[model samples]
Target chain A: MRLLEALALTITNGSKPVCRNQNFHLQAGEIWGVLGPNGIGKTSLLHTLAGLRKPLSGQITLMDKPLASYDRKQLATQLGIVFQDSQDTFPSTVLETVLMGRHPYLSEWAWESVEDISLCMTALEQVALATLAQRQVNTLSGGERRRLALAILLVQNPSICLLDEPTNHLDLHHQMVLLELIVQKTLRNNGGVVMVLQDVNLVPRFCTHVLLMHNADSWISGPVADVMTTTNLQLLYQHSIRKLVDNGVTLFYPE
Target chain B: MPVFSPAVPVLSGRYFLVLFFVALFAALSFVVALGLGSADISFNDIVAVLTGTSDSLNQQIILQIRLPRVQTGMCVGGMLAMAGCLMQILLRNPLAEPYVLGVSGGAAVFALLAIVSGLSGLWINGSAFAGALLSIFLVFVLSRIGNDWNPLRILLTGVVISAGWSAFISFLLAVSPPDQLHGMLFWLMGDLSYVQSSFWNPIVLAVVLLPSLVYARSMNLLATGDLNAAALGVNVTRLQYFIYFASSLLTATAVMQGGSIGFIGLVVPHLVRILFGSDHRILLPVSVMLGGSLLVIADGLARSLIAPEQLPVGVLTAMLGVPLFLVLLQTILFRQRT
Candidate 1:
């Protein structure tokens, strides 16, 4: 089933329509990457697709229903989003923070069951944060905080995951591990994953599909094999590009 | 993964333990406060009066004066603290208190007007409530810039409106008759002596707190960030409205009862957060118990410290809470540094 479908979607910055008449769709077993320069509405487009912001003129359907039709909790059961930046103004333990992902599934005022706690613990373990379950979130390092956010998204266990810059502050080891984890989960469940990424090289390696937004209004999107060629890369990023193909791996460098 | 996991659940056991201990402490504080007033009532007499086995001077003093005063303190303190917690969550601002959003100031303005106009009894309470609701509505409308419930804007509007209310309050006080000045000043400074004997305050506290407690999970999510809460499926806009109106109701009720007891509302939630962590599931109830108990104890000291020349409960709350708050702040800073 198509997990997300956008038709003629035009997202705007205030009254000025930035990305106009854009069409995209994501089905199960596909991992899509969104790439764009800074201030080009990539975050806004991700937000609009996740039903957090309204599209200027478009129709978006999630799970075959209009996006606006699904209520917040109902939509949350199917779609989970990990924000690029999260702040903890108040102190809550890591376990407590991860357990909040179970909120959409639980009834109001209901206590989390043992199963919920176990799921959270398992996600924490997956992110190597089980040892810090009782530690305060504010006390965590930047990479740990990012992993904690990913752990929260994992616990939500949604059918479609939307991540804005899933890796921003992680070391190379954590970056590879986290992306591998996300890909593993999506492939295992035959679920869809859409992420906004700044690392263009990472896209050709990991993404099954790619959407390159150009300045806001124009771009190209298709299977990664077609959309990630040298000419398309130059047009989307507006830079001279050097492509190196070695041992079935492709690398892009600006000249 | 080698950490030894306790058999008890993470949230439930510690929550109940805190609730049980604070409840016990509140009961103990209530009894001690009942015994400390000027009319020398022994513990035995208090017990007898409580058990309904005595009807004399001691029983009269306990039933008529001390009991009513303690009850008022509990309701006012609990509601104020609860309001403060809601405001802190709603604005995502640690320094938010019930009065920080202009609730108490608005209530004070209307209440002072009532006093100056020779109004007493329910008339004062009615207008104070009106003023409170008005301030809440004004802040709500003013802060709704482009359908965005910007926390900073709401905070700024409330603070500015409160400043406006303060000006009006000062103007009222400046022109009042000398005889009415004392009563108006007492009201402004938060005196519980004016609370009439009634069971309504406690009942109202329960009515408001029940709904607020149900939103504990949402409040915890909200404390993280609005985007985080919305992404987690909490209807952030609707929840913000729920918290704002519910907290305004609580603040109006508390201000009507105790004339804006200041320190408990501002400091108790932080103290509770520091001790119990920031989970509202545990923080909310603990704050109520601690806030109520602290105010009752403060009121007791206020009544007895000068021997019939009672001090305003607000003055006592600040005198007591400021030093503890400073110590807690220092400890937090020290922990952060180390």
Candidate 2:
């Protein structure tokens, strides 16, 4: 829709540009990976898209209308986001944390419906955390908390999923577990998954399209096969690239 | 092991919660409070007074003075405790008490202002409510200056403002006209002796504020902490403003009647949290009951222990409440750590 469209959407902190006037199309059913180095504008771009932060200039169109036209409540139901640092240090139980995702669906006086409870259970099951529903987030290990956070977003069931650094602090096992679940659910339902990821390796495995953010201003986005190259990876990181062919993953290290 | 049923688990609801033992206990305490003291009446006599069979001077005292005072105290204590609980939640700081964020002190200043200005006691409530709102507005404006508002910075600003107002109150007493000194001192010390049959407005506020907080559980979840709640799709800004207004109203209404009942707000919610866990479903209502009974019991001792000479109920609450809070915090922390 024209409303959700972003034409030259830019953000900056004083003189430095975070996301330089970028244009992108977000459609349902496609999982888009946001790849970048540290201090780049990937998180900023995600925040602007999520409406958590405002843009300096330009426009965002949704449903052939301006994104700002929809109120926070209206936008929330259609857009679910799982932010970076899913580290919930509170003693809230896994079930309680997951049930919070149902906030947009329920009213002030309404308790969780039978439908809400079952949806929460199914979301946990998708993240393979059905058994740990009663445990506290503070008691869980790093990887477990990451998966539980993913379970929260899944339960929300928004049309567009914006996840920032979802794979950070996760073990290889959970990294694959979360990415596979996102692809399976979004692809099947024809929903959109726009996530910021650190590991360039996982991008090829899960993402159909990738946006590479180098510095704050530059991005080269297209098919994963196009964006993940020795030259682009080296340039993005300002480093010498070493490729491992059999593993289907490339490593970048500073010279 | 036998398989647990796949059906939804049926936890206890309003049968045990709404209008049951909790309410029953509070009602019993209210009756017991009315019957206690020098003119101790039998339950039969108390019943007779209510039934209009007894018209003795003792019956008159029981009906006219003691009943309203005791009932009003219970309502006042409940409002103070719940207000404090919600304020702490809204601020998301464990150390938050009723006046810690300057809302109550701001109310106290306006309340004191109304009293010194020769306004009626009821007018004090309106002034106090407005003052609390204004202070919050000021603090909100101050904290947002030149950057995104930081909660810790706001907390510090509140402390400074509270101390400033408190000192101003002492200054009022020190330099005031001799005739007005006695009343100002009473208000500052927080006496429950002014209770009369006409004083039910605070109860209305308590009833309304209590149900509103209960009905809005999503607000409680957001007030627990901001970022976690926001990622789950809570409109945090709107919720913050609502809680700010609601919590301020609660504190202002409470201070109107309760006269700075210390520690009920701080200790009662902390007790509720420890007993049933941090979920506000159990916390808000339990704090109301426990706080009322605890204050009634404290006031009973305050009046009966030294008889004719009245000790301000605020001192009693602070002395009794603070130690118990320390012990409870230590125990909970020890358990969590181990």
- Note the DockQ of each predicted structure: 0.59, 0.33
Q: Candidate 1 residues A154-217, lDDT tens each?
A: 9898889999998889888888898899888888987999999998888987899999988555
Top candidate, metric DockQ? 1
| Model 1 spans with C-alpha error above 4 angstroms | B1-9, B329-338
**Model 2: residues >4 Å from true position, as ranges?**
A1-4, A86-91, A247-255, B1-19, B42-44, B110-134, B144-150, B170-186, B197-215, B323-338
Note each model's CA RMSD in angstroms: 2.5, 4.2
Query: How many clashing residue pairs are found in candidate 2?
Result: 11
Quote the lDDT for A155 in model 1: 89
lDDT of 2 by residue, A1-255 (tens): 222457897888567797777887787666789877887777778877877778999888766667777776577777777777753322466776777778777766567776788888998888788897765567778777778778878887777888888887888887887788877877776678888887777777788889888765667888877778878988877778766656655554344
- Reproduced native contacts, each prediction: 0.62, 0.22
